[model samples]
Target: MRAFFKAFHYAAKGIVHSLRSERNMKFHTIALIFVTIAGLLTGLSITEWMIILILFGGMLSLEMLNTAIERVVDLVTTDHHPLAGQAKDVGSGAVLVFAIISAVIGLIIFLPKWF
Candidate 1:
């Protein structure tokens, strides 16, 4: 039980570290806050809320993974390398894709109601 609790502590620490060090993570968190506010104001249905939650989770998780990949690539190679660059680019691209998808879903859910 203590080990399990320690695992959660370590996970929280990692989240804090990423939020502090990663600009993209900060942006995602800010977007999450805005989305939550919008959802509350719009009086989102249960299904819409669930979809938003899933997309939010997906975007944030991908961003964290992207950060991890970039960090590991940097750690392994201090000097410039084509493969390392590619790895980082792919990770960033993944986060972009997820962010775009999340934005589109948000529009789909919120636009009609607002306009």
Candidate 2:
């Protein structure tokens, strides 16, 4: 039980560290806040809310993973290397792909209602 609580503490600490150090994380968080408010205002359906939540979670998770990959690549190679660059680029690409998909989902969910 004690270890389980400590695990949550460590997870929160990592999230805080990432949010503080990663500009993209901050942007994603702000976007999430706005989206949540929009959802509330629009009275999103249960299914829509679930989809939004999943999209938000997917983007945030991918962003975190990208940050971790970049950090690991940096740590592994202080000097420039093609493979390290590729690793970071691929991680960022994954995040970009998810962000684009999330945006499309958001449009599908909110655009018709607003317009």
Candidate 3:
């Protein structure tokens, strides 16, 4: 039980660190705040709400994973290397792909109601 709780604590710590240190994380968090507000104002249906929540989780998780990958790559190689650059770029690209998809999905869900 203690170990499980400790794991949660570490997770929370990592989230805080990411929010504090990562610019992209901060951007995503701000986007999440706006989405939450819009979701409330739009009076999202249960299905829409579930989809939005999943997007939120998926976006944030990918961003964090990207951050982790960049950090690991940095730690592994202080000097420039093609493989390290590729690793970081790929991680960033993954986050970008998810962000684009999530934005499209958000528009699909919210645009009709807004207009």
Candidate 4:
């Protein structure tokens, strides 16, 4: 039980660290805040809410993972290696892809109600 609790604590710490250090993480967090406010004002249906929540989880998790990958790559080598650059680029690309998908989903859910 204590170990499980400690695991949660470590996870929270990692989240805080990433939010502080990663610019993209901060941007995603800001977007999440705006989307949450819009979700409230738009009075999302249960299904829509679920979809948005899932998007939130996916986007944030992917961003954190990308950050982690970049950090690992940096730590492993400060030298300008092609593989390292490729790893970081791929991680960033993954985050970008997910962000675009999440934005599209948000628009799909909100646009009809807004316009």
- Predicted model with the maximum lDDT: 3
Candidate ranking under TM-score, highest first, comes to 3, 1, 4, 2
Q: Residues 1-115, candidate 4: write the lDDT tens digits.
A: 9999999999999999989988888988999999999999989999999999999999989999998898899899999999999999999899889889888988899999999
Is candidate 1 or 3 superior in lDDT? 3
Candidate 2 is scored at a TM of: 0.95
lDDT for each residue of candidate 3 in 1-115, tens digit (9 for 90 to 100): 9999999999999999999999989999999999999999999999999999999999999999999999999999899999999999999999999999999999999999999
Which candidate would rank higher by lDDT, 1 or 2? 2
User: Candidate 4: global Cα-lDDT?
Assistant: 0.93
| Candidate 2 lDDT over residue span 1-115, tens digit each | 9999999999899899989999999999999999999999999999999999999889888999999898899888899999999999999999999999899999999999999
Which candidate do you rate higher for TM-score, 1 or 2?
A: 1
Window of ten residues with lowest summed lDDT in model 4: 18-27
Model 4 error, position 107 (Å): 1.0
For all predicted structures, in order, the TM-scores are 0.96, 0.95, 0.97, 0.95
Candidate 4 TM-score, C-alpha based: 0.95
Off by over 4 Å in 4: none
lDDT of 1 at 41: 98
What are the Cα lDDT values of the candidates?
0.93, 0.93, 0.96, 0.93
Q: What lDDT would candidate 1 get against the real structure?
A: 0.93
